[model samples]
Target chain A: AQSVTQLDSHVSVSEGTPVLLRCNYSSSYSPSLFWYVQHPNKGLQLLLKYTSAATLVKGINGFEAEFKKSETSFHLTKPSAHMSDAAEYFCVVSDRVLTGGGNKLTFGTGTQLKVEL
Target chain B: GAGVSQTPSNKVTEKGKYVELRCDPISGHTALYWYRQSLGQGPEFLIYFQGTGAADDSGLPNDRFFAVRPEGSVSTLKIQRTERGDSAVYLCASTPGGSRTQYTDTQYFGPGTRLTVL
Candidate 1:
């Protein structure tokens, strides 16, 4: 079984400041993590993913995340927050199924980021 | 290339009625998935299809929920006896298949269909 927990339900940050969204996951097998963002009335977009390659994964839109096995965390971070960054972000996890041979994503409750100008 | 697309961005149905949501995955994507997101909650997996067969359906909530990928490219989620509790955002995603390490492949998602049961 696998699951994800996003520590913060809501976070507010001013423009040009650092942004942080915390996420923790649990899995029986090797886990693959991802961060997805959804704008108002828009589709969910992939921000980044960690697939056991590099601990530090870089993604589009100046966002990145670090996978810490010891901590069981994959927190998203950005050096500077943009006005357009305000959205709902979800942290997801996937593991190889033993019988199905497919990957099913387990998502976190999500964190709503509010960027202030 | 075209991304995943879902038909009827918004759907409204009366209680006990039946509804079908359609999903068209990206060209050449062999794997398709269905998920549901309730208000203020994350998306929960419903089912997965590899080619024309259902690879995993363990996430389906009940017998009322069913999905199929007859052509292996287009998929549909059918709900029978829809209830108020069943109203939520139904999301569809797809990933490129044939990867030796399938877990590493990224899944592209669609805008989702908002089902409102009244």
Candidate 2:
């Protein structure tokens, strides 16, 4: 079984300040982690994914996340927040390919990022 | 190049009514998945298909929900005896399928169908 937890339900940040959205996950096997953003009335867009490669994974829109096995966390971060960054973000996890191909994803409750100008 | 597309952007039905949600995946993608997101929650897996066969369906809540991808492209999710608790955003996603890359391939998602069961 796999599950994810986004520590924050909502996060407010100034436009030029750093953005941090915390996520933690648990899985019986090695897991693949992902960050996805959803704009209002838009599709869920993939931001980044960590698949047991480099611990630091960079994604679109100046976003990135680091996988910490010791902490069971994959927290997303950005250097600066933009007004366009206001959206609901999800932290997702999946088991390794050995488990039913690992296509079934388990998602966190999500963090709503509010970037203030 | 097109992303995933879903039909009936909004659906409202009374209790016990049957509803079907449709999804059209990106061209050439061979994997399709169904997920449901309740208000204030992230999407939860429902089922997945590789080609025309359902590879995993353990996430389905119960027998009331069923999904099909007969031609390996277009898929539909059917809900029977809908209840208010069943109302939520039904999401569809797809990814390119290959034994080597299936685990790491990104899953592209559709805008979703908002189903409201009253």
* TM-score of every model versus the real structure: 0.97, 0.96
TM-score of 2: 0.96
Error of 1 at B78 (Å): 0.4
- Candidate 2 collision pairs: none
Candidate 1 docking: what grade? Answer: medium
lDDT of 1 by residue, A1-117 (tens): 899999999999999999999999999889999999999778889999998899999999999999999999999999999999999999999985523466788999999999998
Off by over 4 Å in 1: none
Top model by DockQ, which number? 1
Which window of ten consecutive residues has the lowest lDDT sum in model 1 chain B?
B97-106
Candidate 1 residue pairs in backbone clash: none
